[model samples]
Target: MKKRVGLILLLFSVFLVPANPNPVVAQDGKDREYYETRGDIVWEVPTDKKVIALTFDDGPDPTYTPQIAELLKQYHARATFFVVGSRVNSFPEVARLLANEQHELANHTYTHPDMRRISPGKLAQEVAKTQETIYEVTGAKPQLFRPPGGYYSESIVNIAKRAGALVIMWSWHQDTRDWSDPGVKKIVNKVLKNARNGDIVLFHDYGGNRKQTVQALKEILPELQSRGYQFVTVSELMNHYGTKKVGQGN
Candidate 1:
């Protein structure tokens, strides 16, 4: 009776769980080359000039987003915005303005689900939906895709590539952690102290209570400018530095 009940519960759980899209490939003796060259991951580039990509994630918020954009404008810098598709629908005008201001509008996701492990079908849907939304609302489809919370697998990268996006990650040392509302000085230091010529510094525009991010930016923009850093969108920076492939090393 005990064994029978265990079997019954196992079967019930099987019915509820979905299969992983990229099942474990046997590493013993097959398809080793494809395994070696699978996913696209761009964290930073290698350029000699003082140019970097400043990227904002989880945005299109009515409040903080516009303020950040204004700050960027004051510095005459252009940055990329990784926006949630649903928020774009909620505030299409804000998105339109980002595009009009010449900021790159990239895909964060439709609902910002953790993309670390997801089925191929669901991942494809999330990528396609956000691509469509950005194109539909702003008249330009996004080419850069960053996984929610930086949680992405090799399969997730390939899936995003299939949807016509280059997976974007930030520089190893430039993550501000401003989403946690770390003190304004800390956010300022994270970027200013770690600024580099091919660094991709991460910030957020739409997460809760980003006044610290906003405040940090006011200081960051001016200080970085004074230090001779030219800010450009992810795509533009990539173009400037020949980022035709992802994951260029310093």
Candidate 2:
């Protein structure tokens, strides 16, 4: 009878083991390892419709945000802004403006910390705090999260996933290096050479003077228009072209 009881207890413990304990899940039918590592960085757009997402990171600066917003309005284009939480407090109106204009306000962390180096608790706090700040300022919880410097690990994805954010990375980088004030011509050349359909382009709204980057976007938008490209926000692009996973956008 003791041996029988031991067998039952062992079976019970097996039932207690958690299912899907792995921190990452690749929902699009791709191998989880492929999607988890380099794949999450989004090196390319992976489609052919001239649909591209223009995403700006590290933003809501008083000096640059308004200017970029006005330029986007000029082209009747939509973009996503991955904003820092502390900056939201510094320039709340920019958050309101992005919402009013229908651009996405995504989480980029509270102080732009290197997310990979931080503890999971701090990472959760960063994501949670920013989500709250975004909703407080914009009245909507952002569904996406972009790490500072495009850094992510399995643990980062796990923390963000637990916080109910989809990890968003970019494809088709324009690489303006706008932080260094690279000339508009260089920025334009990067996009002109690389711009493609279903691509997500990365730019910055804050971190330094972004005048050349702004000028480059003005040029790139019209030029791409002539080439027959349509601008969409990141979520729209994913929905329209990217492989949809169940439970996504739920």
Candidate 3:
């Protein structure tokens, strides 16, 4: 009876635990070689020039996007907006405004699912649909793609590569964490303290009470400008760094 009870408990435990607890599916081993030869995820550019890329995610928010755009315009700075497909559809004019103002409109997926667990076909659709939406609205296909929530697997990178987008990740040092709405002072301190050349600072124009972000930028932008930093889009940062691939170093 004791052995039988122990065996039953073992069986029950097996059922409780998942085969892959982490949702991100692992790609085939051989595919790594193939993807390695292709593009890589860019964090920051590799240059000595005082240039940085400012990227905003989850927008084209009708209210905050215009304010952010106006701020960028006021600072004479450029930024990259990784927009969601559904938002672009909802606000086509705002999407057009992003492109028209010389800000880049990159893909952030259609529904913004965590790409790690999604099947390749579903992932392809997510990326392709956003690509199509952005192209239709902006007349330009984005060369950059940022995985939702910055969760990436080999499979996710493969899908973005197949769709002709280089995956973009931000430097660990520069993440503003504005999504948490940590107040304007914390957000300002985060970027201004770590400001450096080839840094890609992340911000959000949408996704919630971005008035704090707008306010933080008002302080961060001019301070950085006074310190001689030039704000450029992500692609331009990659070009400046001569980064040809995404996961090259990893």
What is the C-alpha RMSD, rounded to one decimal, of candidate 2? 13.6
Q: TM-score winner between 1 and 2, please give it.
A: 1
CA deviation > 4 Å runs, candidate 3: 1-39, 243-250
For model 1 the TM-score comes to 0.82
RMSD of 1: 8.0
Q: Please give the distance, in angstroms, between residue 209's alpha carbon in candidate 3 and its true position after superposition.
A: 1.0
Worst 10 residues of 3 by lDDT: 18-27
Off by over 4 Å in 2: 1-33, 36-45, 245-250
Candidates in descending TM-score order: 3, 1, 2
Each prediction's TM-score against the native?
0.82, 0.81, 0.83
Q: On TM-score, who's better, 2 or 3? A: 3
Candidate no. 3 TM-score: 0.83
lDDT of 3: 0.83
lDDT string for model 3 (1-250, tens) is 9999999999999998844321232454433234434545666776889998999999889999999999899988989999999999999999999898999989899988866567779979989999999999989988889888776667677788788888887877888889879999999999999988999889998888899999999999999999998999987777656556332332
Best by TM-score: 3
Per-model C-alpha lDDT, please?
0.82, 0.77, 0.83
Tens digits of per-residue lDDT for model 2 on 1-250? 9999999999999998744312232333444446534434343446767787888989899988888999889888889999999999788998999889999888899999864367778888989999999999999888788887655566766677777787777662555556767688888898889887777778899988888888888899898888888888887777777665312742
Q: Which ten residues in a row have the lowest lDDT in candidate 2?
A: 19-28
